[model samples]
Target: MIIELDMSSDTPIYVQLRNQIVKGIGKGEIQPGEKLPTVRQLAADAGVNTMTVNKTYQILKNEGYIRTDRRLGAFVSENINMNAEFRDKLESELELLSAEASITGMNREDFLKLCDEVYSKMKSSPIQIST
Candidate 1:
């Protein structure tokens, strides 16, 4: 998976890493149970400090998005369920964003079109449905 970062942005490096991992999971770029690159490796790839990668990994581990074994390194969490409660929570959270986007000049039609595009792309990709 390719991770692009904006050095000029106010967001922290660890935050960028965490968001990328989340999007990667949602987009199927990183499969469930998939082995993630080592912290040192990802840091080297991103040209960032290893501590930053370690911190991002720690956050992801806490979020149940990744797991690390003593020697196995980090792997994507398997069977991550977006349960009904979680779904409703996400919907509620996104409604705020949708409202903001609307106020910021994104029309409902355009917003939904973008959603459809993303859904199509995600559907075309190999799916890892967690029951």
Candidate 2:
């Protein structure tokens, strides 16, 4: 999987790396037991300090999304939570999204209506997994 960093973003590089990794995992591109590139390698690719990659890896480890082995390196972890913590985190993310939407002049009702429409369409669409 490839990830690109935007130096222009206000968010810190480590946070951006962590967020992108999470997104890759969520999109099913990165699977459990998948080995991540070395921290130095990722940092070089991202054009950031090795410390940034280490920091991001630490966050992912704390979140139970990945674990590092001395010789094997970092790998995607199993046994994740599908509970209140996730719901709360998702809500926090939605709040930021809503704020951005509001800034772009999307009213609450319009946002809700749009959400319903999207949900309806999503419900109608079936996911097809490739073998």
What ranges in model 2 sit over 4 Å off? 99-103, 107-131
Off by over 4 Å in 1: 83-89, 123-131
TM-score of 1: 0.79
* Candidate number achieving the greatest lDDT relative to the actual structure: 1
Please write out the lDDT profile of model 2 over residues 30-69, one tens digit for every residue: 8778999999999888889999999999999987789999
Query: What TM-score does each of the candidates earn?
Result: 0.79, 0.74
- lDDT score for candidate 1 against the true structure: 0.85
User: Each candidate's root-mean-square deviation in Å?
Assistant: 3.1, 6.1
> Candidate 1: worst 10 consecutive residues by lDDT?
122-131
Colliding residue pairs in candidate 2: none
True-vs-predicted CA distance for residue 70, candidate 2, Å:
1.8
Any idea how many clashes model 2 has? 0
Quickly count the clashes in candidate 1.
Answer: 0
